[model samples]
Structures are given as C-alpha cells and as structure tokens.
Target: MRTNQESKRRWRWARGVLGPFAISVLVGGSVSVSSGFRESELQCEEAYAHLEDCCGALHGAISCTYEEGCAGQTPALDVVQSKCIRKLSCSEIEALGMCDASAWRSDAGAPLCP
Candidate 1:
C-alpha cells in the first residue's frame, strides 16, 4: 500500500516536472514557456535567419550549372548550405555573413569543360 507520504512525494515530483507548463485542466490552458527556453528559441531563429541569408548570398554568386565547369564550387556552396549554414557555430555563421562572395566563386558563368 502506498503511504500518504509516498503519494504526496509523487505529487510534488509531478508538480515540479509540470511547473513550466499550464496548470489548467486538459480542456484548455495556456503554457508559460520559460524565459530561458524562449531565449534559446529566439537564438535558433536568428541562427536560421543567418543561415538562410548565407545560402541565398552564396547561391546568388555561384554560376554552376549542369553543363558548367565550375561544378567543383557547387559542392563547396553545398557545404555552406548543408553543413555550415545549419550546424556550424554561431561565430562561424556570423563570419559567413561577412565573407566575400568571391571566396565561394571563381568566376560567374564560367564555361564548363568539354
């Protein structure tokens, strides 16, 4: 048989776990996201925005196409899109913002090798 003390302990633990969430019934209630969690979400949004900008900026300068020779750089920009844009550290993402487009592209519309 569970003692009253044990029941109380379980309730307390549950309260602790659910403290960050809504206290209302399941029918309807508002959740209070912790400030720290909100801040993290904001940071993620900012990072994503920066990453999107990086991809856009890089893709704009790239001249690679199915028939082009600068295809080598396509992989490089893909690196920026798949890796750097999403997984790189914030400082690195910031650096990408300030990077020169020439570094990612040798020449615009360069002819592909036959």
Candidate 2:
C-alpha cells in the first residue's frame, strides 16, 4: 500500500542504482578473454620462447583451451617438452630465445641430442 508518487520514486531510485551496475557487468564481462598463461613464472625471453614452442606443438590444444564451455582435456607441459625435442635442435632451445635458458634447461634436466 504505497501511494503512486512514492512507488514511482522508489522505482526511479532502484533503476538508477541497478541499471548502471547491470550494464557495466555485461560490457566488461564480454571483453575479458581467459588467456590461461600462468603468472607464477616471470616473463623472460626463455619463457616466451617456451610459450611459443608449446603453443606451436599444441596448436590444436591451444584452440581447444580457448573454446567456450570446453570441459575436455587440456595439453600438458610434458607433451610440449617432447614436441620441442622432436622439432627443434638442442642448440636452438639452448639459445636466449628460450627465456632464462639456464632455468628451463636445469628444470628440463633430461639429456638432449649430443
């Protein structure tokens, strides 16, 4: 039992508050893409190189990663490492392009081509 004038005022106040919030969420949510690059590691030359190599191996996998509402398996680092060895020379991987080559090499301690 509110009067017509009071009802109009309340409606106006609710619209003024909720309208902008709803619009902002809709607009902002659309622009955000989940580029699943993990932030735990620093962005170094080696890291970028590794990312490029990994993404190259899992080109299909990367596309799968970006699919909407995708629930299937994602590519793993080991797969990328195997592909890197198969596709690129050890010297190439050892180069500065592989961001913090020392760290990656040490971590990927497996023997490469002599």
The C-alpha lDDT values of all candidates are 0.45, 0.46
Counting clashing residue pairs in each candidate, in order, gives: 1, 4
Candidate 2, which segments miss by more than 4 Å at Cα?
34-114
Question: Estimated TM-score per prediction?
Answer: 0.27, 0.33
The number of the candidate with the highest lDDT is 2
Candidate 2 minimal-lDDT segment of 10 residues: 58-67
Quote the positional error of residue 74 for candidate 2 in Å.
10
